[model samples]
Target: MPTLSDHEILTELDDRMQMFIRRQEMMFVATGEPHDGHDCTFVTGGPGFVRILGVNRLAWPEFDDVSLSDAIADIRRDPRISLLFVDFARGAIGLHVDGKAKVLDDDAMRRAYRALNLDPSLDLVADRRPMRWITVYVEEAFLSAAGELV
Candidate 1:
């Protein structure tokens, strides 16, 4: 097998990858702080609940009554985070995003929500606007192929 350098392992998201992300309704987020262990949780929403803010940034709403404090606290102390989105039905196709994350306050959340311009009538964003948002600044993106980790 040929050796792969970091440059070869990491890549920017292309149009096809972005489309895959848009179709995902669930994602797994993993966060960790030095010497504090790591926490991973599954976040779910309707399709398109997670928005790509730019080529290198994405944001997802944080709903109330969820047990995400450990993950959020870890992010505050150490911004490093990893997100995984997979197509279970199809299998073997997924995307891994490694990045830094921050919890946005209400004002920033509102601005991000507005930027999405989703239909106000959509149940996911209508009366249930999230007060908190987690924004990730992507450092690298990788494609998971046939059970291999990139």
Candidate 2:
């Protein structure tokens, strides 16, 4: 049977949800390896960094170009990810996005975003651009009052 909490879970992000996500400058991403282990870290890219590919899709660039980051490696191997977008501006509920992810280069990532009728505005830096981008196809999303940004 479906419970009230289950009913509160949103399959697609609403306008308000989109706005909140866009306003966030940083978000925590979690990924795991195929065999074992988990990786979670914070990523930032100014406001509107996490692009909304669709109601159930999101993408962000991986800016650490020098090293093979654990999160990146896990995503490549497992593809499962969980993104937490918290509200630093207020003590509000955090938005959770659980999904499968893929890594793409600049051109490919842009194409994918365009295919969804989205504008990959790529305002990351003026001189250099990110070589890799991680796109998530969200499977589930919900808001949690537990990790409120106080």
TM-score of each model, in listed order: 0.82, 0.82
lDDT by candidate, in order shown: 0.77, 0.76
Q: RMSD to the native, candidate 1?
A: 4.0
Task: List where candidate 1 sits over 4 angstroms from the true fold.
Answer: 1-8, 112-114, 118-125, 146-150
lDDT of 2 at 78: 93
Best by lDDT: 1
Candidate 2 lDDT, tens digit per residue, 54-139?
89888877655444388888988899999999885577568888899998987787675566433335555645666778888887
State model 1's lDDT.
0.77
Q: In model 2, which runs have C-alpha deviations exceeding 4 angstroms? A: 1-7, 65-68, 115-122, 146-150
What clash count does candidate 1 reach? 0
User: Tens digits of per-residue lDDT for model 1 on 1-150?
Assistant: 222443234545666667778878999999998999999999888888778877788887776636688999999999999999988876758788989999997577666567565443443656765667899988888777644332
Q: List the residue pairs that clash in candidate 2.
A: none
